[model samples]
Target: MRDYLIKATAFDGQIRAYAVQSTFLVEEARRRHDTWATASAALGRTMTIATMMGAMLKGDDKLTVKLEGGGPTGPIVADAGANGQVRGYITHPQVDFDLNDKGKLDVARAVGTTGSLSVVKDLGLKEHFTGQVPIVSGEVSEDFTYYFATSEQVPSAVGAGVLVNPDHTILAAGGFILQLMPGATEEIIELLEKSLEKIPPISSLIQQGKTPEDILNLLLGAENLKILETMPVEFSCSCSLDRIKDAIRGLGNEEIEQMIKEDNGADATCHFCNEHYHLTAAELDQLRQNGELQ
Candidate 1:
């Protein structure tokens, strides 16, 4: 099925939940970045979580998630908006390692257990809202769960997973986030904890062709979940050639002239999507004449 996420409430709105099947979305990112097995898992997990978080917003609101773990992969950055746009990159996309003791992708080894996970939200306010927390686990899900409980002060359960194929493609990718609202009873929390314990890993469920609704049922019980909305998700980049040209123009006339003199042209590549944009010498001259190259 097409990649999409579902927002829902359970137990009469005391429990807020989100679930998504992001196989195609994560596969697109892997193809764009040419990420290896471990890197694919790491990036896929982050993207899966970011897509769900993007659903939390309305209008043009957007957020950027940064995981700066001092590991082989270095830093992982992802941006998502209410419109379901997302783009991300890893400092090192070729990093790979042997599976962990659990026979799973060694994400912790690739992402490291040290550093922090930070989220910066552009809520259209004078000052954006930023929250951060130390990486409790190099696994992306736990780190996000920690961010919510410690930084956002919301009790949450977060689960994300990505399975990579032997050919270095994505096999499955998906996740879920469930939060307990105020007035949540102790009985409800206990029931949720039990339900979470019995549910399979999100990646495994996706590999089994389980849908987002299946994931929610696994977490909140089949009868308790009340579907609210479903939103399509994908790997989308907002970068364009014009945006790159504007950036080069902002480098000032001196820099533009130096480029025209030393190099016949200029080339720019977006880190998020790896899209290359080339600026011709004639175009540079025109920008200069128009005083666009301050």
Candidate 2:
């Protein structure tokens, strides 16, 4: 099935939950970045969670999740928009290691525990909303859960998982986010916590052909869950050749002239999507002229 996300409310709106199946998008990322097994798991987990977080916003709001764990994979970054669009990348995509004792991809080793996870949100406001939390666990989900509890002052349960195939392609990737709304009763919280302990790993459930709705039913019970909305999710990068040209133009005339004199043309590649763009000598001249007008 195509990738998508569902937003739901449970326990009479006392709990907010989101679930997503991100297999296709994660696979796209693996192919684009040529990530190894462990690196694919790390990037996929981050992107999966970012997609759900994106659904938490409205309108043109967007957010960026930067995870700097000081591991061999370097930093992992995911950019997500309210419309269920997300794109992400890892600084070092070839990082991999033997599976951990649990026989799971060694994500914690690929993503060290020395750094922090920070989120910057552009809500179309005067100042962006920024929150940060120390990396409690190199595991992506725990770090995000801690971010929500410590930085945002919201009690949340975040679980994201990615299963990579032997050939380094993503086999399954999905996640769920559960948050306690204000005035959540003690009984409801207790029930939710108990349910969490019994649920299977999100990726495993997705691999078993479970839909987002089914996942929520397992979490909050079918009787208490109310589906609010569903939206298609994908790996979407907001980079374009025109945007690259504008950036080159912003570098000023001197830089453009130097490029024209020394290199004849310019080549640019997007970090998020790995799409390359070549600027011809004539294009460089035009950009320089455009810069002159500004």
Pick the lDDT winner.
2
List residue ranges in candidate 1 displaced over 4 A.
Answer: 291-294
Per-candidate TM vs. native? 0.98, 0.98
Q: Could you give candidate 1's per-residue lDDT for residues 1-294 as a string of tens digits?
A: 899899999999999999999999889889988999999999999988988898899999999999988889999999998876788898899989999999999998899998999999999999999998898889999999999999988999999999999999999999999999999999999999998889999999999999999999978888999999988898999999779778877888889888889898898988998888888888898776654433
Superposition TM-score, candidate 1 onto the true structure: 0.98
Count clashing residue pairs in model 1: 0
Q: Write the per-residue lDDT of candidate 2 for residues 1-294, one digit (tens) a residue.
A: 999999999988999999999999999999999999999999999999999999999999999999999899999999999999999999999999998999899999999999999999999999999998899889999999999999999999999999988888888999999999999999999999999999998899999999999999999999999999999999999899879888998899999999999999999999999999998888899888883322
Q: lDDT of candidate 1?
A: 0.91
Q: What does the lDDT read for residue 200 in candidate 1?
A: 90
